[model samples]
Target chain A: MHPAISVIFFTVTSGAGFGLMTMIGLGFPMHNGIVAAFLSYLLGGGLAVAGLLSSTFHLGHPERAWRALSQWRSSWLSREGVIAIITLLLFAVYALIWMFTGQRIAPLGWAVAAGSLLTVYATSMIYAQLKTVPNWHSKLTPFCYLAFSIASGLLLAGMIGKATLILGLPTPTIIVIALGIAWIIKSVWWRRADTIGFSQTGSNTGTATGLGHLGKVRLLEKPHSGENYLTHEMVHQIGRKHALKLRAIAYILGGIIPVIMCTFALFITPVFFLLIAAISMIIGLFAERWLFFAEAKHAVSLYY
Target chain B: MTLLPAQTNKKLGLVIDLDVCVGCHACVVNCKEWNTGGYGAPLGDVDAYGDNPSGAWLNRIHTFEVTPDDAPAQIVHFPKSCLHCEDAPCVTVCPTGASYKRSEDGIVLVDESMCIGCSLCAWACPYGAREMDPVENVMKKCTLCVDRIYNDNIPEIDRTPACVRTCPANARHFGDFADPNSNVSTMTRERGGYDLMPEMGTKPVNQYLPPRKKSRPEETTEIAPAFVPKAGEGLLGWLDRALEKLG
Candidate 1:
């Protein structure tokens, strides 16, 4: 799947945004609960909008994205678009109601939080439904997306904590714990994906020739003169050694470093550790997201 | 208008006999000939005589040789194309309503005009059935010759798919899968047909019957004809025989 940079950014940014919003909406009443609650809405709302806007750049016709929301009944992509927009609307309404009434609207916030989570589920299902691509079809993929979002969201919340002195000790602790748990889930997901063998032969040169008898097949002949659409779209040749190095970098920088920094910050200066953790997570997740796309093998590659 | 009653028609499909296929490629040529001139748009080919030659082909034949244990080698000819699966992943993944499965006949089709050329449907297909039409920049696949199958101008007997009509071996058969009494369904039931990559669970409408096996004859040794000695050779042999008797 020639992991387009635009899509990579879209998933990570939007995933983090949605993840953060759901967590904040759920944990609104923790410390300086009112102010923390408001901040959560603001930060989560802003990031979600930013992610959606960035995703539009990938579309050839951004105007057509509007029509995408109409087919939620059948299409997961359409459902995702619809769910995302609805999440935003619900969050806004929840915020407005809270601001005007001063007292918390528990039912409304809970409903909006549920909607935000559904948006994430829909986003994950878009990839999971594709049975041809073994890598994306796993049940773990959606869970991984959900976990990564929450972890990224927690890291974001911790960063927010540093800027403003809200609920002192317990707040940062909770965020760090969430980040740690997310890190573990991602690690397990990576390991599981490694164990499963690809169902389809990555190259289709032999399959096309109808010689399944041949145990091993190499590129015996070039199918065409110049690059065809199949070759360009499917046979993305990212070096194996380079991918291994990138995975290490993603794990250390995106996973380990943030966890350590966040954990350390809980005891030491909350602001210092929080800032480092937040920055590390943002950078790490971007690398992780890039690898997620780069490493994924589309079944169409069999043709090449 | 609720003028006509909702008639439940079973989706028709093809069950190719791989064992019987002769790899003649009659189906491929016939399909190209039928599709190019019949449909909404011609299956365009760029640079037919120039350096690079490429065009849309609905059916392709691939020949393979399989060697079984304690048996002579077997040649299997497979005709490759869309299986038209019941649970088509291609339809679900399309962001636009462009790709859809018809409830009336269960044929998975792409609305070329509505397609945004995202290539998601192509990625979703396991069989590599969907090909991007570079000219139109939209996905293309076997429409089962929909435009020709029901044409009133064509005779009822001749209205079958071009590929089915052209197959000299009669390896290809097409009929409504809903009717168990149909020729294709009965043949499949009797022969115990199988779908390609059943593990994927696409529930492909097209089934492939295993190639029939042939028995081998027993091996035997060959013997040379009896020989007779010439006059000179016989005399030399007699002298040698006398010498041997004397010794």
Candidate 2:
């Protein structure tokens, strides 16, 4: 559970990107003509591609990443990669048709929408399937991912709409509602995660080492004095006070501030406020994603 | 590929006796030594002699103080490597077909050439058995000394895992667990051997024998002090004074 910056960036950025793509596919903002359609797709596609590429940056051998798609039959990571590639390719084609013909194909749009959402789900499954990390191995993990995607996607779509003036902004009420749902999912996720380590259902040192019958088991000595890959990768710690502060920042910036901004956008400069909300949500989500990895307790850490 | 075979012909794994192991870490060292040259990738070290040394190791020994109720505390030397589980999560989680459990012998291995080094396999493993080799950028793990175990080049007596061959205490044993009469199986049945993290449900092939309870003498024997103070031994050095005060 090291809070790897690359993975954090990848999850948050890609979640937003897929969310935006989902919104585009749903025919929101009513994009027309080459410039509007091109800009919309570029933002969505560019963010998606950039996030995907950043995910590879943490790989020991990024060049070998293509081989990851081969084991989708059993591996969630492979499934995510495969599904993501297909989603992006199909979305690209759909964007191209829209950009050139200026016609929104309902069937293709629906397909892209489903594909985009599925890609997000697959990405979430990559974490959720890890029974080794009890915090992530839950139905709520996928729910949180999907909820965040829709929330961020809706906000980005509204921003794109405002920037292009192709159509009036999406109902601000809807944006606020999406943000509310996302906040609720996130609150539940954080609460569940916080209590999991102390929960009876979670793994512990005694159960991990099969020494519960011995009463209390404590480490007398470690294997080595030096650090190893396990210690470096899985034994991350964050202060409680720091984490609390970050959580507040994440909620306020990622959810509350955006909701407030959306609520007031109609009363003030709608464009400026919507744009601010979009940026704030992303930055806030970045903090939340960082905490997601930092707070997770890997079962392997029990041995250490 | 990543899909595990319905059944393995043999479950070849290790049985570690916590009662006998002295926490010498000889198995850990020998496993790394033999595997560095034998396996898919050389087990490597970064900043080996520098301020902060980090590396990939196949085997690790953890010493834990186990205090049983109504019993004296005992230190248990726990040596952990790959369990080579019947339901190996690491194998199924590998994005490439790099990680696989052999249906023939049930040895889980990483096909280094195919590994993308994405590290999802490591995350899935409850034992922290697989490590990402910083140098090769591929997963490195205990192959259970696959090369030595099956090699004709080595002497018959030496045809086992490097760790087992090198254990001075004879605490480590290697054999097939599938055969009812196998030494490992018999030992497991007799010793009440248990799997680590059974709750994780990996159904690990490896088993660990718990440290046996200590037996105290029926009668306490009080012996005379080793040294009798002489008539004029009033003063001594600071070290002697410190020892006297400790006494």
Candidate 3:
């Protein structure tokens, strides 16, 4: 939960881009012709590829990233890498076919769309499957990922549509609905934070040291004077005051504000409004993802 | 390949005596020294001899002051390393099949060549056993001295973890948990040894011996003093006075 900027940007941008690609794969109708198709595929593809490249900045050996795809049978991370590659490749083919034939292959389009969405799910599972991070371990984690991806995708598509005057209120209405779903999932996830073993009682200092029989065990001294890898990476914590403020920001920007803006966009067809709404939601989702990391308390912190 | 074996032949692990550990950090030091030169990755040291120093160490010693309601405050030294769990999440979560638990001896290991250093295994591990070496850019962890214990060139008595061999207080013991007659197994059975975070379902092979209860004050009243001063022991001139006069 260190909220590394690279990871934050990667998750947010890639998620939105994949969502946009999913929409494209679904053959979203465009009144403004190929611009919608071109913009969605190119922008979405660029964001995803850029996000992926950015993620490798923190790796100790970025060259070995291809090896990560080998363990997909056991690791969600591996699955994510493989699925993401497949999705991106499928999107490329899907785009090429669209460009050359000027005809939509419904089955191939759906496959591309499904692959993109599955990649997002795999990404979410990378965190969701971790029992050590209770805030992310629940079923709600994937639900949030799916909801946010689609919401961001729909909103981005809706913005492109409104900007080009390609489509009508139906896109905005769908964006509004997706935003609401994301809002509900996030609300419940945040609320259940306390109930879902976040307190680390199961693996506290007392239990960790096998000294719980004595009494309350408090840290008398850390193992070292300076921050080691464990303290640096696993013990990233946010203060309560800052966390509360961030939570409010996430709700407003990621959910409520976008809902209101998209609702207005449904009435007023100004390109600026829809565009700004999409941008704000992107920024808002970035905040939300940062909190998703910052708020998760690793089980290892119990020893500290 | 990351899937754990249905059963391991030998659950070889460490058994630590918390009651007797003096917290000297000999185990930590020896672990680093041996592993760095042996099969393990070079334990990197950063900012050594500077205002701040930190590095990757497979084992660490933490100290705690505890005062039970009826007992006097006591300082307990806690030595922590990888427990090599039966359900090693770190191994299972490794995306490159780099982290794995050995079925023959139940020791968890990492193949640095295959490791992408994504650090997902570190997050999956509840014990915080793994350390990312900034120098190597890969995960490093306690291998239970796999190279030492199985090496035929080593003396039979020295065929144990570096930490166990180096414990000044003799608080660390290493043996196969599967062998009922093994020294570690007997000690664990007799001392009521227990696992750390059993609820996590890791089923760690390593065990910790709880602090034994001390006798009440009345019971040891007649015991002789550890040292009895001879005549004229209370003189002002102690060993320091002699050194000062020479100076």
lDDT string, candidate 3, B1-247, tens digits: 6888788999999999999999999999998899888875688888878988888899998988777878777788999999999999888888889898888999999988888788888999888899998788899999999999989998998898999999989999999999999999999999999999887778899999988876566555433354344333345446656656899
TM-score of each: 0.76, 0.92, 0.91
Candidate 2 lDDT, A1-304, residue by residue in tens = 8887888899888988999999888888555889999898988888888899999999999999999999999988898888889889888899989989988787888888888899899999999998888789889999999999999988888776743323344466788888999889889988888778725345688987788788789888889997788987887775233788899999999988999898887577776888999999999998899888888888878887
Local distance difference test, per candidate?
0.70, 0.87, 0.83
Best by DockQ: 2
Worst 10 residues of 1 chain B by lDDT: B219-228
Better model by DockQ: candidate 1 vs candidate 2: 2
Write one digit per residue (lDDT tens) for candidate 3, span A17-87: 89988887787763334554566578889888888888887777899998888888899988988999998
Model 2 bad stretches (over 4 Å): A162-170, A198-202, A238-241, B217-247
In model 3, the number of clashes is 0
Score residue A23 of candidate 1 by CA lDDT. 57
User: Model 3: clashing residue pairs?
Assistant: none
Given the true complex, what DockQ would model 1 score? 0.16
Index of the highest-lDDT prediction? 2
User: What is the fnat value (0 to 1) for candidate 3?
Assistant: 0.78
Per-chain TM-score of candidate 1, chain B: 0.82
